[model samples]
Target: MSGCMSSSDESDVSACNHEDQGDASPMEIPADDLATSDEDEEASNPPPTKKQKTLESKKPKTPSQIKKSTVKVGGKCSSTNCSKKALQGGHCFEHGGGYKCSEEGCTKQAKVRGKCVPHSGGNRCTQPDCTKLARLKGLCIAHGGANVCSFQNCTKTVQSKGKCIDHGGGKKCSKRGCHNQVVSDKLCFEHGGGN
Candidate 1:
């Protein structure tokens, strides 16, 4: 009985070895073929190097490097010497083209409400009950719209100021006793102010 059991166990081990060999054979054959194919592909088409890619991206595009980027609108502007694209009325925006204001006697181009800003009351003052066009700070001129001098009680309009030029707002001339305003380099126009 011991001899019979040993023979059966040997047969079982041999069967398992055969099954393993069969599975390994198929797997190994495909793996080898795939590696060879990948090597062939790499040899045929080498990828661009980092330096080559960088140089290609840095290259500037020329006028005729390709084709016109904008889609062909089939026609050009009606104005002579103008090469701009034409809108629906065969004219460009600068050439009095595009939808006009729908308001009676208003020939200006319409932005909204079928009328221009002035006629349509667009950009009105933010001040309560104020209908004037907004000039600055969402307010009209009477509502402190423009920037004024920073000096006390000074009403002069300025880019920025402690006072207006007459009251020493800007840099004065560097010449001794010169009251003229400085143009550049701390010198007045007559004193060779930096041209």
Candidate 2:
């Protein structure tokens, strides 16, 4: 029989008998290279259990990955170029997100109770005989639901900075060296305000 040893039937019997080993003398391993015992070998290089192997196969994910996975529903709208809040189905009402209005032939987003604003979808004013939309405290803007102007003896609603536009409360003209209030398109009456 050939001196080369078969891979099978080899039990704790090591020798330079492989086909590629040739006539070289048996390899000598230093005493320091051997493990002290089976216990030391197990501790140093233990085979992973089924559970451990499963876990090892899975790589740890980052915090952003975890967060993105959790945002499957009720997060930011998924529609393109839309940054509005999401209601359901991962989209905003304007971008076909939430429930559509209940009125027939109406595709607008529902404001309240499955209806649009024009179809009486929102809360009505609580004041007697008032059919206008409620603004604050169950009342409409004309019924004291809005803030009044802060100018002396001024009862008009505030346009900005607690004052009406008549008292210089709105945005000013964008023209250089012009302090006049904007009448149209950010320009004063003298600078293409009507246009």
Best candidate, lDDT: 2
Give lDDT tens digits, candidate 1, residues 18-125.
566675642365578889999999999999999987564333322233234232232455557765554434455455444566677766656567566667766778
Residue 21, candidate 1: alpha-carbon lDDT: 65
Question: Candidate 1's C-alpha lDDT?
Answer: 0.61
- Measured with C-alpha atoms, the lDDT of residue 32 in candidate 2 is 53
Clashes of 1: 0
Residue lDDT tens for model 2, 20-67: 445544574445557456568889898988988656323222222222
Model 1 per-residue lDDT at 3: 42
Q: What RMSD does model 1 have?
A: 18.9
Q: Which stretches of candidate 1 lie over 4 Å from their true place?
A: 1-135, 138-144, 159-161
Where in model 2 is the C-alpha error above 4 Å? Answer: 1-118, 174-185, 188-195
